[model samples]
Target: MGSLVVFFQLAGAVALLLFGLSLVRDGMTEAFGVRLKMALGLGTRTGPRAFLSGLLATLGLQSSTATALMTASFVERDLIRGRMAQIALLGANVGTALTAWFVSAGIEAIAPVLLFSGYVLGRRKGPVWLGTGRALIGVGLMLISLALLGHATEPLRNAPEIAAFLPMLDAAWPVALLFAAAIAALCSSSLAAVLLILSLPLPPGLTVVLVLGANLGGAVSPVLATSGLGVAARRVALGNLLIRGLGCLAALPVAGLAGAALTGLALPGAGLAVEAHLAFNIALTLLIWPFTGPIARLLTRLLPDEEREQEHGPRWLDDAVLKSPLLALTGASREVLAIGDAVERMLGQTRHAFDSNDPSPLAEVLALEDRVDRRQQQVKTYLSRLGRDASEEENRRAITILDYVINLEHIGDIIDKGLAPEVRKKIGLGLRFSAEGYQELDAMFLMTQENLRMAQTVFMTRDRDMARRLMELKVDIRNMERQSAQRHLIRLRDGQPESRETSSLHLDILRDLKRINAHIASVAHPILDEEGLLIESRLRMG
Candidate 1:
């Protein structure tokens, strides 16, 4: 019963720690996600800047894993180079250790003050205030959890079961390494694992081994998360893992000596765990940073890009199904959904290209636009062939699908001709949007992407509620675009340097995105019109 109670207490403390970390991550993202993304995207112009970006992003997010995943996504899109990505993650590794060190700085006494401040600030409005408040609250929670963790483990120091089990771990150091690695991997957080390890009363060498294991295991979560991002993403993540794995392999042989040297330092016991974490990453960064270029090249050869099949027309539209109007309409609906998918891809690639000031991704965006054009035409032609014998409702369904495909094609055109060229000009002329201007545009891009996805759902399901929600979001997008343009003009009036050459590009993008949003909102019309919900115009008849 005592053992179970102790286990529950430990688990609760760990859970609180993880929750605190998430709050910090979420708050930072909500407050400054755009600027952070831009820093990570643009900061890769040099290796050192890339490293700093990753380090700072990790510190703010309280999760190196999130930084890694974000970095992998950029690599996948070719917005950042593989070599720089590896270096950045090395920085992220150091950041994680720094976080562990900072939290262990004997300031748990201020937890209540931070908690109160965070709560008061959290109640305030605006992204910055709310985000800062949430982050402070998270920090306070983490500190409190650390105190609780100490209390929980104070008993383990006297527990006979722990005394026996810990010695068993000391006799078999490799087992201890794997045990800590497993804990970090399971928690998906090395900081949590290190803090937990800090609270325990382990032998000096064993404590070092556990920290090493935490570093090694910390690389696992990002690698796993990158599976869905793409091959380049996977490569970036896998590269980090291999680097850390190699470092661990070399360090494992000397854990005792390094542990003894650090433990020999006149520092306190809690400091030992954090110092081990910090020292390992610092040493690993110095040793590995120089070799990141060669290592990235090696990974490319080891995991060469998979060969893709030639692009072909409309995968979902089947002629055999044309005899059945129901099947034919369903296939067309699915085909339009696929076109929306392509459009989403185009927007993503375009946005990345703009952010990086690189025109390479625009080539894929063009290719995808062509694919979108071909698919939409096929959808239209297929519907034209649907027989007159079809019922009125069947004909109406065909028309609805036609309307959606046509609207989707308009979105494609806007992405292809409007946003793509503007982005190219912005990049080609070396024009930079003011930080405020760019943040506004980026927010619209994200909102439009989400609204596009929601529009797809509305078209397929024709759910009145989702349709209404999408329509409402369309209004929000328009308002956002208008507000952004107004802010850009204000910046211009004030003679903001960044607003000078990029004025036309910024306004053009806002207009195009708003137009695209208007088209996407049209998909909700039929569903809404059926429920007597859509207004023909906002104007009042005189």
Candidate 2:
């Protein structure tokens, strides 16, 4: 019974720490998502800046894995160079270590203070305050968990069972290391693993091994997540993994010496585990920072880019499943989802081309447009076969899927024929919008992208509230377009040469983006109508 109590208490403490970490990450994202994204996008111009950006982003997000995956996504978009991404992840590793060090500063008494302040701030309005408040609350919970962790483990120091097990565990350092690595991988957080190790009463040598294990395990999640992304993204993630894996291999042989050195420092409240984690990462970064180029090149050679699949009909519309309406519908849904993804890529390529004023990025848009057309057509046909004998609910779902894919097709056309041509014209003519006008257009582009993402979610879950939110965003996009046009006219009247030269282009881009968003927003229409929240006509009854 006592052993079970201890286990539960340990699990609870670990759970609270993980929860706090999650809240901090989510809060930071909610508060500073756009700015952070902008900073990351703009900050990777050089190796040093890229490292700093990665470090700062991880510090803000409290998860190296988040920073790594974000970097991977950027690589996919060709936003950040592959070498720079690897360097940035180097900083992210150190940032995670630094976070562990900060959390281990033994400030458990301030938990109440942080909790109170967080509550007060969270009660106030706005995303900034709410996010910051939630983050503070998360921090408080983390500190309290630390105290709880300490109290729970106090008995472990003298437990006869642990006393019997410690020597054997210590003797089998390789097993201990793997054990810690597995824990970190499963939890998907090295910081959590290190903290867990911190609470244990263990030999310094074994402690160092476990910390090394955690670091090694920390780099695995990103690699696994990004395995299917792209050659560039895989390189970034795999590079980080290689760095950590090699560092662990090199450190394992010297764990005892390193642990003894740390022990001799006798630093107050400096848990050997976290301190080792911090030092190990710092050392690894310093050692591997200069080798990022070589490692990136190596990863590229090993993981050559796979050939893009030419349109071979629908990848997800399995004909074998057509006998079962439900199964067929599910397959069709997946196929439409693929079309949505392709449409998203088209919009992204358009934005990239527009931003850089380079027609090269527009090259991919045409190919993606063709893919979207082929897949969407196949999906429509696939679903048409199902609804003939389908039940009412199944038929409704089929219609919903059909509606979404049609909208997606329309969006693809707007991007390919409308937005892509507009962007090319801007690039070909070398016309530049006024600063205010450009910002307006760029904001619209980002808004449309976010709406497409939300639309995908709405299509999948059919959640009425989210569907309503998606419906409401149409008003916001319309206002944004109107206000941008008004601003452009104001600039024109003010005699801004840039505005005069780009007026037609600016307005065309805005109009196309607005049209695209309208189609994307249609994903929510069926969900809202089903919930009786959608009216047929916008005209007020006279």
Candidate 3:
């Protein structure tokens, strides 16, 4: 019963630690996600800057895995070179190690203070304050959990069964390593696993092996998370995994020597696991930093790009189903939804290209636009064959489907021809918006993407409330665009160099995005008109 109680206590402490980590990640992301993303996007111009970018991002996010996935996304958009991404992950590893060191550095005395301050701040309005407060609360909880972990493990220190098991694990380093690796993988956090290991009483050599395992397992989560992404993204994640795996392999043979060296050091108050984690990552970074280029090339060759299968015609539109008007209309609706998906993809790529200042991502926009055109044509042709015998309601439904698909097609064209070209021009001319202007445009881009998603839902469900909300969002978009344009002019008048240089480009993008939102919002109009919610005309009493 005592052992069981101890087990629950340990489990509870670990859960608190994980929850604290999550709070920190979510709070920081909410508070400074855009600035962090922009900094990461812009900071990778050189090797050292890239490393610092990753280190700082991980420190803020409290997860190297998050940094790795973000970096992979950037790589997918051609924002950062693959070689630089690898180095960034190297720095992220070190950052996480340092985080562990800090957590275990006798700071639990301030837990109550942090938690109280966090509560006080969290009650305030505004996202920035709320997020920062939540982050502070997370830090407090983490520190408290560390203190609990120490108490929870005190019983195990004298337990004969655990003492017997330690020697067995110490005897088989590979088994011990896998055990720790599995713990890390299951937790999805090496920091958590390492902290847990730190609480256990174990030999120094065994601690080193276990910490190495935690590092290896930590890299696996990102690789798995990004496995479905493009080849470029997959390569970046896979390269990071390979680097960690190699580092672990090389260090495994000398675990004893490394462990002895760490123990021999005069550092006080530092746990063996934390010290080992720091030493291993520092050594790995130094050893692998120079080979990042070769590793990137190796990854590219290993994960060669697969040929994309050409989608010639509508996959969902079947001629045999045309005899049934209801069935045929359903088929057409599904096909139109697919086109909506394609448009969303194109929009995402365009936004990514804009943010990264890379034109490579735009290369897919034209192809997706062509696909949208061909698929819409297929839907129209298929719907035209529904026969003159169709009921009036069925015919009305067919018209609705056609209208929505046509709107989707327009959005695709605007993205491909208007937004794509505008972004390319911005990149080609080395244009940069003022910081305020950039944030305004970025906020609009995000809202536009969100509105597109809502429009899709409205198209399928035709819910009156959602339709109303979609119409409301249209006004919001217009207002945002108008305000952003005015702000751009204000900055230009103030003689801001970035604003002056990119004035035309910024306004053009704002106009195009607003136009796109208008087109997408059209999906809600027919629904609104049918429900007697839509105004017939904006022109009122003379």
The best candidate in terms of TM-score: 2
Model 2 lDDT, residue 176, Cα:
89
Q: List TM-score per model, in order.
A: 0.77, 0.81, 0.77
> Where's the lowest-lDDT run of ten residues in candidate 2?
33-42
Better of 2 and 3 by lDDT: 3
Error of 3 at 272 (Å): 2.2
For each candidate, the alpha-carbon lDDT, in order, equals 0.87, 0.86, 0.88
Give the deviation of candidate 2 from the true structure as CA RMSD. Answer: 4.3
Error of 2 at 35 (Å): 5.7
Better of 1 and 2 by lDDT: 1
Error of 3 at 336 (Å): 5.1
Ordered list by lDDT, greatest first: 3, 1, 2
Candidate 3: stretches off by over 4 Å:
77-79, 120-130, 264-269, 317-341, 344-364, 376-408, 423-503, 513-542
Model 2 C-alpha lDDT per residue in residues 142-218, reported as the tens digit of each score: 99989989989998999999999989989988898899989999999999999999999999999999999998888
| lDDT comparing candidate 1 with the true structure | 0.87
Order by TM-score, highest first: 2, 1, 3
| True-vs-predicted CA distance for residue 47, candidate 2, Å | 3.5
lDDT of 1 by residue, 1-542 (tens): 88888888999999999999999998887676655776777677688999898899899889999999888977875567899999899889889988988887789999999999999999997666888899999999999999989987888998898888988988887888888989999999999999999999988889999888998888999888987867889999999999999998888889889889998674553477898888899899899988999999999998898885566877778999888898898888888888998898898888888777889989988999899998899999999998667889999999999988898889999999999999999988888888788777877876677678778888888888778767877877778887888888899899998997888888899999999999999998999898899888999989
